[model samples]
Target: MKSNLVHKVVGSQYPLWRTVLLIIVLILGLGQTYVSTHFYLLYNKANSQHHDVHHEYYISVTKPINTVASMSNPNANGFTNAEIKNIQNQDFVDRVGAFNPTLFRIVIEPPKGMGHQDFRTLLFLESLPNAFLDVDTTNFKWKEGDKYVPAIIPRSYLDLYNFGFAQSQGMPQVTEGMIKLFVFNLEVKGPKGSHKLQGKVVGFSDRINTLLTPESFVNWGNETLGSVSKSELPEQLLLKLKNPLSSDIGSFFEENQYEISKSDGAKAALTNLINYSSFYVWLNGIIVCALSIIILLLVVYLSIASSKTEIMQLFFLGYGVGKIALPFQKIAAIKLLMAAFISLPIGAVVAGMIVKNSAQLVPFNSAGFQLQLLLVFGALVLLICALVVLLIKVRIKRLSV
Candidate 1:
């Protein structure tokens, strides 16, 4: 009997009109979840595709010589063997100090377990850079082993080398670095067997440069011909430049000058992956928020218009109609808050997955999952708070006396 009375009170107090509003709110909340999840999924898919596109070619630059000039200490100033090989004076117009050849060589030394073929797959997926590989076949001739595999990037890669010469040293600067670098597609024979590989010039700063490749520098030899030893490589050669080019810089090298390993469709998809997903996330948020507001307003208007009799009776029964109306305002605020909360995590998870998969699928280094999670969670909380406040202000004004 008590249950029936409770039901009757609920039915008459809310009526079909208010009940329908509650149902609509629930649907909208769920719909927000669905949209947020799918948006993230779609964003991840798009980001992955873009990353694939940009990673087709791998590249790197080497300073065959190392020259360290100490301004503070004269005794420490001297040219190392690396300086002699890499830093050319103004004499060699085609060298590093010359007209800023954006295109350079990126040599790879594969590890023991990895073969040339496997390495190549990894390289291709990494979006091979505009560099070449010097396969040392000297052992093959000397010990009846394989010959040195030669992969030469065309002069076109050179054209892409944009580091402008320092008027004095003629070395390229990251501020004026080439928009694109060389892609070196080469094959090597590890202890196990032969493997194909590629790398890209994802970063370059100062005289030092960095290449993203599947091939590790472990088990490398002293011969500077094929690949540089891991110790020889700097810790941070490919640091981000403060001044990057704004334009869509094209390849620096000429097309016919060098032959690059063919790029697969998957390799070419990474070009604009992250950028596009970011844009989409922002756009989706804007659209969803706008739609939520409109839906809330419509629901409130209908609830007020249709439930006049029920509301009046409640007022007569010693109930403060305004207080009862407070729930409607609360529901609207909750709807907006929940939708915003849902969207942020969904977008962040999608971004993190995309970035993580990107590092695995390609050769780039993505931030940790924890960082992405924190960022996403923070964004969601902030958005929820902001939306709740806005909804409260809007809904409170519509409450009838």
Candidate 2:
């Protein structure tokens, strides 16, 4: 009977308790995996959204303008009219083709009290760039049988302002009458230009149109009016660049180092902006990962410590002699394996969920998701391995006689 009991105890594996403990550890591991995955996804989504918003806001603030000068007299600059036009045409083409056109700002300021309908109608007539204007519908009474007024500006004008024109044709016509029209001072350049402009709001398209007219230019005050002189004009005709991707521009400008002395400061400012935007997400991710590792290590240590009494009891129950038979190596191996296996998948799932859910909340680029997942999973695996090794070493030492 004694020998049979001993054989049963030694040969039999750990009872329900150890299995229960392992299950609990696995549950904890899975939970951590889910949370970690979710956190990573959230972080990536936040980072991408932050970058887009920063880029948009930065572009809005930094508007660039290309200046073309038309000389008063060809003899003044020792150049012919044709040469001057050629130079300006070439310069316009080169500059417009080189950089992002959408970075330019086209402001259209109609004189106060102008009806939105009339303004919109005139816009279609003039073929102006689409203008972002606030309409006060409450005060203005709508007139029946009045055609819908469309913003008017030419495709060239939109190109100049780095704006895209609507595809629809036929703008609404406005009644022929003198309305309050102001001059527009266009600012085309990025943040560097904005700084140079010193917060000066450029004249609107309507204002520029009013001022450019032969009669209007002649009547304008001399002090407030200026024209592009031919002498300072460039050779290239400025045409808008087709695509505005940073990478595309980078590739285009690879050979030609178009150095802007002022861009250094602007670049530094942009870096700071990006850092500020992404700081919170980065910090949170770090904290969560750290906490997870610490909790996992603590659980492993407690499990090892608690298993000692049970392991010794099993040894005596299997053998006649009341001898300590704690197989520390096997127990430690199990603990290490369990900790690692449990933590990895849980972290990955959590990170994935977080990323997927965050996409719903913000504009996320799907292309980046897989890359992020791979990076995060790799990090989690490394972390769990490191923790398991450390815990196993400590447990083995404690069990050694």
The candidate maximizing TM-score is 2
lDDT against true structure, model 2: 0.38
User: Residue by residue across 1-401, what tens digits does model 1's lDDT show?
Assistant: 63343224423433566545544554454344444444454455545655423322232222223244333433232234464343232121122211111111333544444334344332211112122222222221111122332222333334354333233345443331232233345554433345454433333222112222212122231222233222332211111111112121113212212121223112222333444555676567546645655666666555555556655665566655445455555555565556545554554565556556545654433345345544554465456445645554454334435
Residue 96's lDDT in candidate 1 = 25
Give candidate 2's TM-score: 0.35
The parts of candidate 2 lying over 4 Å away from their true place are 1-15, 22-26, 45-361, 398-401
Tens digit of lDDT per residue, candidate 2, span 88-127?
A: 3532122221111121232343334532423421110111
What's model 2's lDDT at 262? 35
Whole-model lDDT values for every prediction = 0.38, 0.38
Q: What is the clash count for each candidate, in the order shown? A: 77, 57
